[model samples]
Target: MQFLVKSARPETLKTATLVVAIGEGRKLGAAARALDAASEGTLSALLKRGDLAGKPGQTLLLQGLAGVKAERILLVGCGKERELSERSYRKVAAAALAVLKTLGGSDAALTLGELMVKGRDAYAKARLLVEVLADGGYVFDRFKGDKAEAPALTRITLLAEDTDLLACERGAAHAQAIASGMAFARDLGNLPPNLCHPSFLADEAKALAKGNKALKVEVLDEKKLKELGMGAFLAVAQGSEQPPRLIVLDYKGGKKDDAPFVLVGKGITFDTGGISLKPGLGMDEMKYDMCGAASVLGTFRALVELGLPINVVGLLACAENMPSGGATRPGDIVTTMSGQTVEILNTDAEGRLVLCDTLTYAERYKPQAVIDIATLTGACIVALGSHTSGLMGNHDGLIRQVLKAGETAADRAWQLPLFDEYQEQLDSPFADIANIGGPKAGTITAACFLSRFAKKFHWAHLDIAGTAWVSGGKDKGATGRPVPLLTQYLLDRCQ
Candidate 1:
C-alpha cells in the first residue's frame, strides 16, 4: 500500500473515501465539524435521526453529500474526545479501515491522525494508522489452493495541518518500513515446518544480504558448530535430518569501531519436544517456535530500509527438535559454546540450550548490549497471558530501555524478576546447571539459565511464547511482535 501525508481540508479533499472521527454524544471532531458545516448540517440531521451512535469503533457511511468532494464519507466513532487513548485510537482507525475494505474504493484519506491521542503526537498517530491498516490487510494464504482476495484499498493519505505535515510524513515513511518488516516476519513464521527449517532460514539471511551493501551474511554449519563446541545447540539438531544453522547478519551503518547492538534469536523451526514429547494436541502450532528468529530478521529488514546509522548484528540459532533415536534425551549432559555443562532433564526445554550457546557467541562482538528473543516457556503464557511478552534481564538500564521501546511501539512487555534467588531452580547435582528449572517460575528460571552465559555483557531476554502467535482459531497466525519494539529501540538509539 502507498501512504502519503498532506495538508488538506476535509470538505474539499478529493478522494474515493474520506474518513473522519466522531466523538460520543454526537460530538463531531474538527474535520467532521468542517464537513458538517459545509453540508449545511447533513451529519447533524443523521445524528438527530439516531442513525449512528458515537461509540468507539462504530461507523456511519454517507454517500454523495452535496458539499463534500469525497465520493463517500466514513464517520468512525472514537468514544469521548478527552478519553481518547492509543488503544481507542487504534480501534477507531481499524474500524474505519475494516469498512473501507468492503467498499469499491481504491484510495482513502484519513483524518484520524488529526485527532488528539493522549501522550501521542502527530507522528505517532500517523505511524499507528499505517501499522494498523497494514496489520488488518495481512493474509497468509500462500499454501492455499485458492488464495484470498486482496483488499481494494491501496493508497492511504493522512490529512494533517501544514505545521504537522513533516512529522506525519516521517511517521508514514517509518511505518511503511516497519510494516514491510512485519510482513516478512509473519511470512517466515507462518510457513510450514518442512519448508522453513534451519537451512532454509540460513538461505533467507543470504537472500536478505543479496544486494544490500550494508548487510553481510554468514551461516555456520554443523561442522563449524562442532568446532566451536556448540554441543547443546547440536544436540537439539541431532534428531532431525535437516542440518542446523547458526545464521549471522551483520549491519554496519555507523562508524566501523562502534560497538554493535546484538540480537540473538532462538530458531527452533520445528519443535516436537525431542525425547520429552509434547501433547499431540496443539503441537501443530510448534512451527511458530522460530518466531523469535523471524522477528530478528524482520527488525533487520526495517533497520536497513530506514537506513538507520547504527551497527547491529543478528544471530539466529536455528535447529529442529525431533524425538528420534539420535535425539538428546532426559538426563543427558551437553557442553555449550560457553563451556558450561547443562543437564537436560526435559528435552522440551530446548530453546535456552540453543540460545545459551548463541549468547556466549555474542560476547565476540563486544556488543553495546544483547537482547535474546525466544518462545522459551509456556509458563510465560500462564503468567502474562497473550497480551504482553515476558521480559527479564541482568542490567536495569537496558531493561528499562527495552521496556520503554515496547511502550512506544505499542507492543508491550512486562519485566519478570531476575533476582539471584531464582538461580537456584536450575541446580543440578550432575552438571553445571539444569536445562529445565523445575516447574515453578518456569519463565524466570529460563531467563536465569540464559543469564549465566550472558554475564559478560549487558543482556535482556524476551520470552514471547504467548505473544508470538494466536493459537487454534480463525485468527491463528504469527503476530510479528517485538520487531516493532526492537526496531523502535534501534531508532531511539540513533537519536
Candidate 2:
C-alpha cells in the first residue's frame, strides 16, 4: 500500500476514510471534538444510548458532517494515550487496517493521537503511525493465488500539520531501509531452491557489490574454498555438482579507525541431508535453508539505504547439501580453516560445518563483534518454538541491548545459555572437534562448535531453526523474524 504525509485539515481531507483515535473512554480530541460540535453532544448521547464504553482497539462508525466537513469519521480507540508506546501503535494501526479492510477503503489519513505522545511530541507519533501502517500491511503470500483474498489497502496517509515529517531523519530513513531489506528477504523465500542454488546466492552478492561504492562484494569459488581449507563446509557441498561459494560483502560507512561489525549467515540452498537423507514428506520445504543468507542480504540493503555511519561486513557461506555417491558419510573427518578436524557423525548437522569456516574467516577483519545466524538444529525448535529466535552470545551487555531492541521492534528473542559443559560433547576420538555435539544438546553443541571459530571477540549466534520456516495447511516458507531484530540491534550499536 502507498503512504504519505499530508497537511490537510480533517473537514477538508478528501479520502475514502479519515480515522481519528479516541484515548480510552475519552472522546476524540480534535476531529471528534469538531464532530461533537455538529451533533451538539449527540455522539456522547449515543454512547449513553447503547451504554457503550470505548477501550483499546474499539471502533465506532459515525456518519454525516454536521459541523464536521468530512463525510465519515472513524473513532478509533487508542487505549490510555498517555501510557501508549511505539508498541501500542501496532494495536491502533491494526484497528485501522481492520477498518480499511471492512470499508474497502482505498486511501486513509490518520491523525497523530496526541494522547499517545508524552513529551516526545507529534512527529514521533507520526513516525510511529507510519511504522504501524507498514507493519500492519505486511502479508506473506508468495504462494497465494488470485482466488485467495486479503486486505487490499492501497494507501495510508499520515496527517499532523504542525509536526516536521522528518523530525529525526535518521529513524525515518532507517525504517524505509528496513522495509527494503525485508522485501529482499521475502523475494528469496518466495523462490524455490532449484532457482536459488549455491552459485545463485553467490551471484546475488556479486550483483550487490558490482557498481556500488557502498559495498565490495566478493565470491570465493571452490578453488578458494579448498585453498582456505574449508573442508568442513566443502564436505557438505561435494555431494552436489554445484560448487560451494563463500560471499563477502563490505560496507565502510564509518571512520577508517572504527572496527567493523561482522555478520555471518548460513546459505544452504537445499538440504537433502547428503547420505543421511531426510523423509520425503515436507522435504520440499528445505528450499528455505538459505533464509539466513537472505537475512544478511536484507541487513546490508538496510545499512546501505539508511547510510548509517557504521563499518559493517557480511559473510554468506553458500552450499547445497544432497545425497550422492561422493557425498561425505557419517564418521567422516573434515578439516576447517582453523586447522581443526571435525568428525561428521550426523550429516544433518551440516549448518555448523558451514558456519565454522565462515566465522574463522571473520577473524581476518578483527571485528569488534561477530554474529552468525543459521537454521542449525531442531532442538532449538523444541526449545523456543516458533514465536522467538534463540539468542546465545558471549557478551552480557550486548545480549541485553539486543533483547531490549527486540522488544521495541516487536521481534522477540529469548537468550539460551552457552556453557563450557556442553563443549565436551564435541570431543572427537580422532579429530580436534566433532561436528555433532550429541543428541541432548543439539542446538547448544552446534552453537558451541561455531563459537570455537569466533575466539577473542564478542560473538552471538542466533539459531533460527524454529522461526526460519513454517509449514501448515495455509502458510509455508520463511518467516524472516530476526531480520528486524538484528537490524534494530545494529542500529543501536551504530549509535
Candidate 3:
C-alpha cells in the first residue's frame, strides 16, 4: 500500500472513502462536524435515532449522503476525546483501517490523524496510521495456490496541514520501512521448516545483501565451525542430515571507525528437542523456533532501507535439533568456542548451546554492546506469559537501555534477576558447567549459561520464547517482536 499526507478538507478531497473521527457520547470531531453539516444533518439524524453510537473501535458507514462528495464516509469511534491515550489512538486508527478494508474502494483519505491524541505529535499519529494499516493487511498466503485476491484499498492519504506535512511524510516513510521489515521476519518465521532451514537462511541473507553496498553476508559451514572449535553448537546439529550454518550479516552504515552494535539470534529451524522429544500435539508450531534469527534479519532490512548512520552486525546461529543415533545424548560433554565445557543433561535445552558459541564468536566484532535474542526457555512462558520477553544482562547500563528501548517500542521486556545465586544452578561435577541448570529459574539460568561466554564484553539477553509466536489453530504465526525494540534501540543510539 502507498501512504501520503494531503493538506485538504474532507469535503473537498475526492476519494473512494473519507474517514473521520467521532468521540463517545456522539460528539463529532472538527472534521466530522464539518462533513456532517455539509451532509445536511444526515449524521445528526442517525445519532439522534440511535443508528450510530460512538464507542472505541465502533465504526458506522454512510454511503453517498446528501451533499457529500466522497462515495462513503466512515466514522470511527475515538472513545472520550479528552481521555484519549496512545493506546486508544492506535485502537481508533486500527479500527478505522479494519472498517476501510471491507468497503469497496480503491483509495482513501483519512482525517483521523487530526484527532487529538495526548502527548503524540502529528508525525507519531501519521506513523501509527501507516504502520497499523500495513500490519493489519498482512497475510501469509505464499503456500496457498487458491489464495484470495488483494484488497482494493491501495492508496491511503493522511490529511495534514502544511506545518505538519513534512513530519507526516517522514513518519510514513519510517513506518513503511519498519512494517516491511517485520513482514519479512514474519514470512521467514511462518514458512515450513523444510523450506526455511539453515541453508535457506544463509541464502536469504546473501540475497538480501546482493547489491546493497552497505551490507555484507558471510556463512560459516560445519567445517569452519569445527575449525573454530564450536563443539557445543556442532553437537546439537550432529543429529540432523542438514548441515548447520553460522550466518553473519555485517551492515556498515556509519563511519568506518565506529564500533558496531552486535545482535545474535538463535536459529533453531526445527527443534524436536533432540533426544528429549517434545509433545507431538503442537510440534508443527516448532517451525517458528527461528523467529529470533528472523527478527535480526528483519531489523537489518529496516536499517538498510532507512540508511541509518550506525554500524550493526547480526549473527544467526542456525541449526536443526533432531533425535537420531548420532545426536548428542544426555550427559554428553561438549566444549564451546569459548573453550568452556557444558554437560548436557537434557537435549531439549539446545538453544543455549548454539547461543553460547555465537556469543563467543560475537566478541571478535569488538562490539560496543551485544544483545542476543532466542526462543530459549519454556520457563520464561510460565513466568512472563506471551506479553513480554524475559530480559537478563550482565551490565546494569546495557540492560536498562534495552529495557527502556523495549518500553518505547511497546515490545516490553520484564527483567529477571541474574544474581550469583542463579549462576550456581548450572553447577556440574563433570564439566565446566551444565547446559540444563536444574529445573528452577530456567530462563535466568539459560541466560547465565550464555553470560559466561559473554564475560569479555557488555551483553544482554532476550528470552523470546513466549513472545515469538502465537499457538492456536488459525491464529498461529510469528509475532515479529523485539525487532521493533531492537530497531528503536539502534535509533536511539544513532541520536
Root-mean-square deviation of every model: 0.8, 3.1, 1.4
The residue-by-residue lDDT of candidate 3 on 76-157, one tens digit each, is: 8887767578788778888888888887799999997777777568877777678778888889998898996888999999
lDDT of 1 by residue, 168-286 (tens): 99998998889888999999999999899999999998998899999999999999999999999999999989899999999999999999999999999999999999999999999
Model 1 TM-score, 2 decimals: 0.99
Point to the candidate with the largest TM-score. 1
* Backbone clashes (count) for model 2: 1
For model 1, what is the error of residue 228's alpha carbon versus the real structure, in angstroms, after optimal superposition? Answer: 0.4
lDDT of the candidates, in the order given: 0.93, 0.77, 0.90
Instruction: Give residue 492's lDDT in candidate 2 (0 to 100).
Output: 81
The true-versus-predicted C-alpha distance at residue 54 of model 1, in Å, is: 0.8
Query: At residue 70, what lDDT does model 1 achieve?
Result: 97
At residue 150, candidate 2 shows an lDDT of 57
Instruction: Say which prediction, candidate 2 or candidate 3, comes out ahead on lDDT.
Output: 3
**Predictions ranked by lDDT, top down?**
1, 3, 2
lDDT of 3 at 204: 97
